[model samples]
Target chain A: MAKRQLLLLSSSQLHGYEFLEFASRDITDFLSKNKVSTVLFVPFAIKDHNAYLKKVEKPLNQWGFKVEGIHNQENPVDAVEKAEAIFIGGGNTFRLLKALYDTKLVTAIRTRVLEEGVPYMGASAGTNVATRSINTTNDMPIVYPPSFEALKLVPFNINPHYIDAEPNSKHKGETREDRIRQYLEEKDSCTVLGLREGALLHVEGYNAVLKGFTGAKLFVRDQEPVEMKIGEDVSYLFKDCA
Target chain B: MAKRQLLLLSSSQLHGYEFLEFASRDITDFLSKNKVSTVLFVPFAIKDHNAYLKKVEKPLNQWGFKVEGIHNQENPVDAVEKAEAIFIGGGNTFRLLKALYDTKLVTAIRTRVLEEGVPYMGASAGTNVATRSINTTNDMPIVYPPSFEALKLVPFNINPHYIDAEPNSKHKGETREDRIRQYLEEKDSCTVLGLREGALLHVEGYNAVLKGFTGAKLFVRDQEPVEMKIGEDVSYLFKDCA
Candidate 1:
């Protein structure tokens, strides 16, 4: 049976191997420990495809895992099927969705990650794909497809690159915290995770724990964040009833 | 003297025109009335280049103004100087931004619009390019640029296809009304136009009035929407503050 685990990292270089650096530090360690270094980079969704290609190429090989780069936007369904561990980096989720929809790869990744369980790891947009909805990313409306439900790797939503209120803007605006609160005021029972860099959500079986970071606030409407720590069990994080 | 009047439309087919049928009704009428028989579509940001190519082919010919397409992504910068009345259509603003950023068309368009006084118009993402910050756009993050600012055509943020709340989602989340309010609070002092389909801001000397359709609403924080009609004038919907 394939081992199913998700490594959703914040944007910080992780050691162990370099080719897979743009992902979280904790993620690379998970890969190192599992002895699964070979990886695939999805470039169709990113703006700096060439930059990222160079970023991941060397480190992946250094970590003793073969690295593969897929550039088939026109026929991504094929690229996705042949890959082992799939990493969806951060960029524009809608644009990524549109590209995937255009190439018909959304369902392929869904099948591969959910059904086949080939170790899914994503950072910004990647972590976003794990959620049931992605109405809260920070980007532009290059286009709007009527219905937008994400990859839904997990049941709740994640607000990656979650930031604290800036001193200058704090006096006037609502941070992601405030925004989710508004979302909460309406849907009093939605689980939202506000993650900062160096954070990773490691899921195996019925447990999830925040790994390798701090200041990553987890929020659900109506309830305050249950303070999280690296190496601590997270069954308590999602234990409360909806 | 160059004609400074610009006709910005919502996304759709151009009605009553023999060609370019899939444009907003409001824009087509403005074109018909202004006797503008031709238009040039800058498709630097669109996914399907062929569909856009055919969109402007027919009506522009019918209007008797010869039309051509200038794809910045496919061509060099020297061609930007030859263009006139460049109407950037609505598609994916992020894609367009990517293309513009890639081709340096963002600087070219700003030079053309501001320096040469090219009659400029945009809808949707096209509309977004006219703002100081594309950050307010409700699209997904497939990529992360350092910033989400745009051309600042009117020194205001535009929310086209201004969604309020889906009937099913109406009571379940932060309504669109509440979201922009949060942006206002964050921005503290900036004008935001929740321009509904068919509603537009026609700018002339000291004259920015809401014209065309009636279904639109404009909001500044904590203030009621000041309605729009064919010939009513309003000042900074948020008053002197923004």
Candidate 2:
């Protein structure tokens, strides 16, 4: 099998920064290193695909890459199959997964990224679908897809935009840590990677590295979460992945 | 058909208060007015149902009602059918709904509450399941339930512990309003009730009333959300309910 390539970002835009500004250099480096020119963008996560495409195109265009939305294509699967690189933007996780299933692009995109070695980049919801399932997503169930099963391009699930509990807040709701803990309570075998904002994970075949500005929380069943900073090799997480 | 009696609370406990302290009066009154003495408690939302029952029993017992956990019963459906009243406490929504389906208590509880007029009280996750669906819940989707389709004892969906956006916050995740709007964007026909902390809805047959300390926001498709305060009669929301 070809070396699977994936770039999963916790978020697209950071506070006080332009869209994708926080990771502009990392994104460009990933694409350029892969020798990518034209990019296929999946904007199905948001309600208006065209508007989402426009927002994404401005940055990629400045980076000297032509961006095309999969929604604009006659056949989305064909677009994924023929694309040099694929970038799925963030919005609502359920909506994105539903559209992927509706357009029959799950298998096609999975095959392209894992087997054909097509460079795949994802932010937030996009990062969510690249995992085994979207159960740990913070997005509401605005729409119910056929299943919570995702692309499974990676072995572990990613909780993007992961935040810590406010020290002084008096809210009675479960904290982010509590939610992730509860997730482990239900599915103990699966691991969850809580990617803080401005954090990203880069994977090439089984070699995964924690990248970007911020740190991440690695959650395993029945164990204390390990704090991982940027520039750390997290490839050991893929030891059990086939 | 018998009068459907229900009291759905935004949360079981308010910040800085003991469990159920904030809504203790409302709960007691609702049960008292309905002439209920024995309450069957559905503690399936939490992992340890026995511990959940112990916490809830303290408050209800002090109010002079016998509290029994459905988990201790041989058949959960039989427990629901024979109860004078039913109370579901707060926890994870997905786990609660899945347990309801697993125990075959969905139809049983619906019949007991709607057809037999058994007084039903729910807090947080419990309040979510009392509605048409659990799609609006704030809880993480730790486990995949058979469906998002809920009890439907009420026509409109209830979003318990609904909070507004932090004005000065830098987090880019979608706000509560954005989530509800997104839900409407997907399913335009459904309505969502955003119940703030310390808020609740009391339903008697076709009459519904907003009660407790705080207020609620009512969302309709393509319409501005209306602010509803405590002591307001929200019976109009049940007009379309059969």
State each model's TM-score restricted to chain B. 0.78, 0.97
Backbone clashes, candidate 2: 0
Candidate 2 chain B superposition, TM-score = 0.97
Interface RMSD (one decimal) of model 2: 0.9
User: Which runs of model 2 end up more than 4 angstroms from their true locations?
Assistant: A240-242, B240-242
Give the range of the ten consecutive residues with the poorest summed lDDT in model 2 chain B. Answer: B233-242
Model 1: CA > 4 A from native = A1-3, A12-25, A32-37, A72-74, A167-171, A236-242, B1-242
Across B38-67, the per-residue lDDT of candidate 1 in tens digits comes to 555777545566677667555556545556
The DockQ of each candidate is 0.09, 0.79
Candidate whose lDDT is highest: 2
TM-scores for all predictions: 0.51, 0.98
lDDT of 1 at A58: 62
The CA lDDT at A54 in model 1 is: 69
- Candidate 1 contains a number of clashing pairs equal to 26
Candidate 1 similarity to native, TM-score: 0.51
